[model samples]
Target: MAAVEIAPTVNPVTKAKKPSFQIEWASSSSEVKEAQRLRYKVFAEEMGANLSQNAEGLDIDEFDAYCDHLLIRDQDTLKVVGTYRVLPPHKAQEIGRLYSDAEFDLSRLDHLRPKLVELGRSCVHQDYRSGAVIMALWSGLAQYMQKNGYEIMLGCASIPMADGGHFAASLYNSLNSDQMAPTEFHAFPRLPLPLDKLNGGLEVDAPPLIKGYLKLGAKICSSPAWDPDFNTADLLTMLRLSDINPRYAKHFLGL
Candidate 1:
């Protein structure tokens, strides 16, 4: 696929260009490397993840070669500020499976596989954690899904386990009752979070990303998975294009 780059236009009222942020698909190996470096800084330096490729200061994995990376760059600084890596079905097939397959059993989702895309390694630079950066990333994703005829978006949205997973359990307890997907779409975790042992009653605040997913009508596909390497509990999240909130879908797709 060819790279897609979008830049904001100047506002006529102020006669000045907006603080620019552009979204694009990583077009070359170097661009992908830049995304990896950003991921490393966020995941390792900030989140304390002991990344496998720490030697290069990059959070790279085997799946990167088969994924199309969406990047949000600060046009003024010319630096990648946010990124989301996507693996379309064809590319996932080439690699034998999606990245989420490593953490969960996806056999039950076979029916949706044809129209599904795996989204992973999502992170934003600390300086650009404002809502605008995330909105830019989502806008790009909406365009990618529509352009490629994809219907289902799948990914693991993580909750930090720093508090021994009380917050993760609490978040799951709150959402599972209403947002759990249908039985056929449920996935089983290889290393499941021990919900019974955790304090699910605590009114812990959900992570901003997870909360955003809920607002967009995403479903929690199953219980949280314990990822030792990343030191987080990951919940399987899925969003069907048809189920997106009408206002958001229209705004994101410009319809």
Candidate 2:
């Protein structure tokens, strides 16, 4: 596939021009390595997770060889700002692992036969945590998903808090996904959330990103799971193509 090119645009209200960022599927081995370097920088160096090196300051595993790497680059400086890895269900099945499977039991969904895409290792550079960087990444993913015939997107939405389990329960209490939650999925057997705690009393002030997913019709799948690398508990979430609201499709996908 050809690399995606994005052009810079000016903000109507501020009358200021913002640098454009392009998102594309990594086209070469070197590009993939660069993407991995970015991931290592974010997941390991910045976030304090362990990493194995391949002599180029990149953290990579067998899973990366088979997955598609989506990279976002600033138009002017050509610096990579954000990235996300997409793994198809067939590849995941062959490897006997789904990114979220480490936390959630995915066996029950076997009968559904949906073409699933696992999105993970999502990150944005600290300096470019603006809306444009994120929008570019999603736009690129949408284009790739449209091309690949993917029907569902699933992943672990990791929270970066030391006491993430407690926060996750509180999150679920307010944005309940009980109807679509996986019956057999959970993080740990012990430390089960008290019934009273699970009661719908989530704080009115939850994280914006989590709330955005709920608004996009994503369903939380069971309890959150502990993510050692991220030092947090993460909730599994899924977005079926059909479940995505039309307004979002029009706004994001330009459909």
Candidate 1 residue lDDT tens string, 28-107: 99999999999999998899987886667898889999999999988788899999999999998888888888899989
- Against the reference, the lDDT scores of all candidates come to 0.88, 0.72
Candidate 2 lDDT trough over 10 residues, lowest sum: 186-195
Candidate 1, residue 6: Cα displacement in angstroms equals 7.4
Top candidate on TM-score is: 1
State the displacement of the C-alpha of residue 41, model 1, in Å, after optimal TM-score superposition: 0.6
lDDT of 2 by residue, 1-255 (tens): 777766567567776564577777888899888789898888788877767755777878778987999999987788888998988878887887776656666666664434888888888887888777777787787787788888888887776654535566666566644435556533332223343544334464556555666677777775656566567557677777777778789866667
Alpha-carbon RMSD of each model: 2.0, 3.7
lDDT of 1 at 25: 91
